[model samples]
Target: MAVTYLMLARLPEGGLGAFDAYESAVLPLLAEYGGRLERRLRTLDDRVEAHLISFPNSEDLAAYRADPRRSAAAPLLESSGAAVELLAVRDI
Candidate 1:
């Protein structure tokens, strides 16, 4: 079954640059796993970023999560002091 996820990222004030770099590098990898980034949003203050993403199935989502490139980019997110939350969602 197709899967959708809501990802919320809380970024540190001083680490916005790192967060941007991290996302720029990693977000593209989703496509390799049959995933799409449906929507991406950010608060005016740049404190929070929200992503609406979908994958062909849960396995695809897991594969994306374990992608080597994404794992390599983890330090960037960690260094940015970003807190991330991911939730599975269903359309109404």
Candidate 2:
């Protein structure tokens, strides 16, 4: 299995709204491509949010990353003013 962690920093101004839409709309679409959200959290101290997504393997992760739904949601996320930092890990 493989896991991808996304640390998201919402853009100033409309961050919360954007993050909400992303969680409601975009994250669900990832499941259709074999991705599952393992964890999600909002950090008060750092003023950022984080998501941990898992896939069966690298191929599945790739599929999720390349999915049209993900692509479609990009603009909405951008409009909402959000940026993501991604980290990937492979299970032993």
Candidate 3:
């Protein structure tokens, strides 16, 4: 079954630049894994960032997570100290 993910991140202190870099690096990788972004949003008040993505299946999601480029960009998340919450769902 197809899967959907709601990725919520707590932006880092100097969040914009790092977040921007993270976005640039990761977004395209999703497509390679048979996934696409459905919606992306961020709130000014809490600076909570969210992205809604759909994938063909769990395997696609796993591959996306394992992508080398994505793994390299992983450091941006670490240095920025962003908290992340990933929620996965699917149509009933």
Which ranges in model 1 have alpha carbons more than 4 Å from their true place?
Answer: none
lDDT of 1 by residue, 35-62 (tens): 9999999999999999999999999999
Q: Looking at candidate 3, what is the lDDT of residue 46?
A: 44
How far residue 4's Cα lies from its native spot in candidate 1, in Å, is 0.4
Model 1: lowest-lDDT 10 consecutive positions = 11-20
Clashes of each: 0, 0, 0
Quality of model 1 by C-alpha lDDT: 0.94
Q: If scored against the real structure, what TM-score would every candidate get?
A: 0.97, 0.76, 0.89
lDDT of 3: 0.85
Clashes of 2: 0
Q: Candidate 2: global Cα-lDDT?
A: 0.70
What C-alpha lDDT do the candidate models reach, one value each?
Answer: 0.94, 0.70, 0.85
Better of 2 and 3 by lDDT: 3
TM-score-best of 2 and 3 = 3
Model 2 per-residue lDDT tens digits across residues 1-92: 55565555645555677667766777777777777888788866435777777776778777777878778777767777666677765445
Between prediction 1 and prediction 2, which has the larger TM-score?
1
Give the C-alpha miss distance for residue 41 in model 3, angstroms: 0.3
Best by TM-score: 1
Instruction: Give per-residue lDDT, candidate 2, residue 72.
Output: 73
